[model samples]
Target: MVAKLRPYRRPAIILAITAIGAAAIFLGRPAIAEAAAVDGETEFVLNTFAFLIWGALVMWMCAGFTMLESGSVRTKNASMICLKNIGIYSIAGLAYFVIGYNLMYVDVVGDFIGSFNLL
Candidate 1:
């Protein structure tokens, strides 16, 4: 029995050593609260960065939708779908460039509406 089990001993010892090392590393690491002490300005910057990333991803979703729709539709209608998607996104971009940015950022003291000035 001993001779039969001798071949597995080396592999078992290696696995045990690896597990102990992993455990030590995990135990020695700092807690999340201690490592994530973001200041107010840093928090603001992070928030702005997150918004930019979210906006970019949202804009790119139009292309993704176009691809998905064109691929799922018939060959005869795929071109039409792609064109429609492109046109819609172009108009949306123009509108946002012209008015959306101003509306979002400019100081308007109204409770429900913003100024019409170009921002």
Candidate 2:
């Protein structure tokens, strides 16, 4: 019987060690007091930085599209293509900020009605 159990000893010990570690995790878990939690100003700064980084990524995509179009077209038309992209982006940015934003939260359900979230 001991010989038969010999092969299983290593597996059992490994499982025991992992179980011990999992139990110990709660002891070392990080805790923060409500008073020490992040404030509104800190959250605002973080949100602004996140928006800036996202806007930068979008600008890179716009640059890539312009480059692709410029590389494919004739030399004379390259400037026109660049101008067209700039114009479109400018108009879209203006419209989104000035008008599109106000329409987003109008008469919406789901979260507003304490219901399930949707895609």
Candidate 3:
């Protein structure tokens, strides 16, 4: 019976992973809704949460790109490509937080950009 069941294991594992991912997203919905409800001074919390979620999504995309690149590239270049992608994400995130964010939101002399609040 165990030998007979082995061939179907891959599908079962995929289904299990899919179900777990779905459950996690479903559980997170309520927290997102609650964060959205906050207003005024509490709005910053919501905004921060939104940014964090966006960053997480970007990180996820980076992971996918890393996987695709590693798979498509030659064996000799696979490690280098993966490392380059990782470095790009690291530098981009750091630069965005340290300089780009400030430049975009701070030192603005016109209405087109935001002011330096550092909230």
- Name the candidate that leads on lDDT: 1
- Model with the higher lDDT, candidate 2 or 3: 3
Give lDDT per model, in order.
0.86, 0.79, 0.82
By how many angstroms RMSD does model 3 differ from the true structure? 7.9
Clashes of each: 0, 0, 0
Candidate 1: clashing pairs of residues:
none
Sorted by lDDT (best first), the order is 1, 3, 2
Candidate 1 positional error at 85, Å: 0.3
List the pairs of residues colliding in candidate 2: none
Q: Where does candidate 3 have its weakest 10-residue lDDT segment?
A: 110-119
RMSD score of candidate 1 (Å): 8.0
**Model 3 misplacement above 4 A:** 1-38, 103-119
**Per-residue error at 29 for model 1, in Å?**
16
State the number of backbone clashes in model 1: 0
Q: Residues 24-110, candidate 3, lDDT per residue (tens digit)?
A: 989767676666555665877767788889979988988998999999989999999989998998899787877678766466677
Q: Candidate 2's residue-wise lDDT over 1-119, tens digit each?
A: 99999999999999999999987986566655433678888987887789779989999999999999999999999999999999999998888666554454234554443322222
